[model samples]
Target: MTDRRYTLSKNERLCGKKNIQELFNEGSSFYFFPFKVYYSFNKNKTEGDHCALFTVPKRLFSKAVDRNLLKRKIKEAYRLNKPQFYNIPTSRPINIAYIYTARKMLNYSDIESSMIRCQKKLADNILNAQNDEEKN
Candidate 1:
């Protein structure tokens, strides 16, 4: 059987214009090197079922092929490192957008490393926020 943990299933992809708008409107964000991460908690979603969106702006990559390649790289990185993000203790599901901010193409290894770092940082940020709220 294929390992589900490493797969990026359709349900795991954030879709629909309304959902996208809500994520950008209400989500909190952070920048880590080549990516800008935006995330929000979804109270209605099932546990451990986070959704993510990958974006490569047209302004930076005018060619559709280039944009698609970058997006694929980003998605692969996320799929591989997703289990780490799941380790973060949370009652609600998370919606995330990983917007590629780099002007040029980067090696897959570089993108993967940055993705790992971003995951760790995001986990720490979420834990800190949860702790802060609990104490207040």
Candidate 2:
């Protein structure tokens, strides 16, 4: 699916225990509605770029089924809207984690729009970071 780069590939997912730990411990974070996005950027290179992890907190969602449902919705939203970040004019290879922070479960559309906003904000953040470096 060369034409469809939006497909969530294995490489495009935030894997490995080390990678995840680094993101959580040292990455920057921001909140967008039901999602709390934690991200780290490696601005030296663009290749091997942009991996994501979607999560539903077990503390808020007691049931496994409920957590799974939320994760699926979040994944779908990210997959559909990720192209916005893919085309960013920056050298950073971004690693992000989307953790569902809301206590109540929201339906698909709410999650989708929030995901869109999150991606847009990420793009803006990248642009701002680039601009900051230029000014420095």
Candidate 3:
């Protein structure tokens, strides 16, 4: 069973208008069905692992309840799959924002699977970046 400590805390949430703007402006993103993941490596030492922000567009999800539900599901999925990414040997901390792009709310299973895929892809990306730097 996943420990309670592994659960996302307030400190693990990506915040600040300036940092968010930079992340959107400079980060690379990829779509995984209902989610669009934006990520970039942060070399600063504030956090050892990654921090995340979850977003659901108001234009797409008009109801506050619907938007909140999707947000909860997405967070749960990420919380479960985060261990793999955390275990990947890397020095730089990563910042991630998961933007919900789908018009409709997807089921939990779908969200979980997508989150898993996103984590694996993210790990691959980190590995590739490390390899590229080593090659230079």
Candidate 4:
């Protein structure tokens, strides 16, 4: 059987000042076509585990239904694509926040494609960062 690595929770989310600041200050980021990801390096967290924070602005999605729909799409995409991160060495927990930048809503296929691309970029970044650290 295949093991699952990524999971989202209320407390583990990047909600507070410290976590958010760390992500902005210490973490590296990757941007895909439709999503911008901000992630932070951690030394105390576990390997092969992740939590997500998603934002769908009211400015872009005026109605609650629209915002909720977008959020649901993003979450579903993340859920399916999260296993890709398992290949990276996870010494610490990484906090990832996916901010939607598109002006219009996207279909599931588009979201899924974007998410897969985003996850691959993130994995590449992590691998490169680790390699750099090892070389230094």
Candidate 5:
């Protein structure tokens, strides 16, 4: 049986042009291999909320099928690994964008491993920021 918590629901999908623009403009970003991650901490949101955007640019992947396939793989990797990523206690939601930067295709295992590493780094950053805020 599949766990419902692992499912990527509509509420967890980042949407709206305003929200996307805000994330890119104000978010802190880091690159981890095939992905460039942009993340913004949302003070307006309640605790333990997070939303993610997965984008495989049309410029890199000319075909719709290729872009969709890559997006699917990335989303699956994230959905499975997200529980660990959210273990940090925070007062607000996180808005994250995972932009695919690789030119060549990668297998699922490769993507999943990268996702795990990326999540660790992201958690570190979030903790650091939280500590900084508390110190201030």
Candidate 6:
């Protein structure tokens, strides 16, 4: 009913062999300036909400502190902007993983802008997917 309804939990962080495999195999993707999003619908595991996983590769961010900093920025952006996703119907749930693909660390402003762009794109994608389902 509310945006806070879709926040991710520890168990939904995209672990386990099958979930990881599905992420690689079936996920559709979108790329903003600094982030790449991979998402898929899991009929079996879905409830009335969506969940997310955020990742930053160690290869790109050599320092753990830098990685954690970026992760926090991304999380904050998500927390603030998640109402857009929650506005969608609750009958089906989605699993999304966002990978930070930037080569350099960015400030909070840049991360917030990128997150807004990502959320807009995600909303568009969901609408299109729903339209397609209605057509079929």
Candidate maximizing TM-score: 5
Tens digit of per-residue lDDT, candidate 4, span 1-136: 1566455546545667777777778877767878888887754566535657888888988999998999999888887676666556655677888999899998999999988888888888877877887899
Model 3 over residues 60-119: C-alpha lDDT tens digits? Answer: 989999999999999999888787777787767888999999877789999999889888
Off by over 4 Å in 4: 5-12, 43-48
* RMSD of every prediction: 2.3, 2.1, 2.5, 2.6, 2.5, 2.2
Model 3 weakest 10-residue run by lDDT? 1-10
Report every candidate's CA lDDT: 0.89, 0.85, 0.84, 0.77, 0.89, 0.79
Over 3-98, each residue of candidate 6 has an lDDT whose tens digit, in order, gives 265454565465667776787688889888898998877666647557678899999999999999989899888877777756776447787888
- Give candidate 6's whole-model lDDT: 0.79
lDDT of 2 at 129: 74
Model 1: lDDT equals: 0.89
Q: Which candidate, 5 or 6, has the higher lDDT? A: 5
Tens digit per residue, CA lDDT, model 2, 1-136: 2244768989889888988998899888988898899988854346765889999889999999999999999999989887776778766678889999999999999999888888899788878877998999
lDDT score, candidate 5, position 47: 61
Q: Report clash pairs, candidate 2.
A: none
Return whichever of 3 and 4 wins on lDDT.
3
Residue-level lDDT tens digits of model 5 in 1-136 = 1224888989889989999999999999999998999998975677645999999988898999999998899999999998877777776889999999999889999999999999899999988988998999
Please give the range of 10 consecutive residues that has the lowest summed lDDT in model 5: 1-10
Off by over 4 Å in 5: 1-4
lDDT of model 3 at position 36? 88
Name the runs in model 3 displaced over 4 angstroms: 1-4
TM-scores, in order shown?
0.92, 0.90, 0.91, 0.84, 0.94, 0.86
> Which of 3 and 5 is ahead in lDDT?
5
Each model's total of backbone clashes: 0, 0, 0, 1, 0, 0
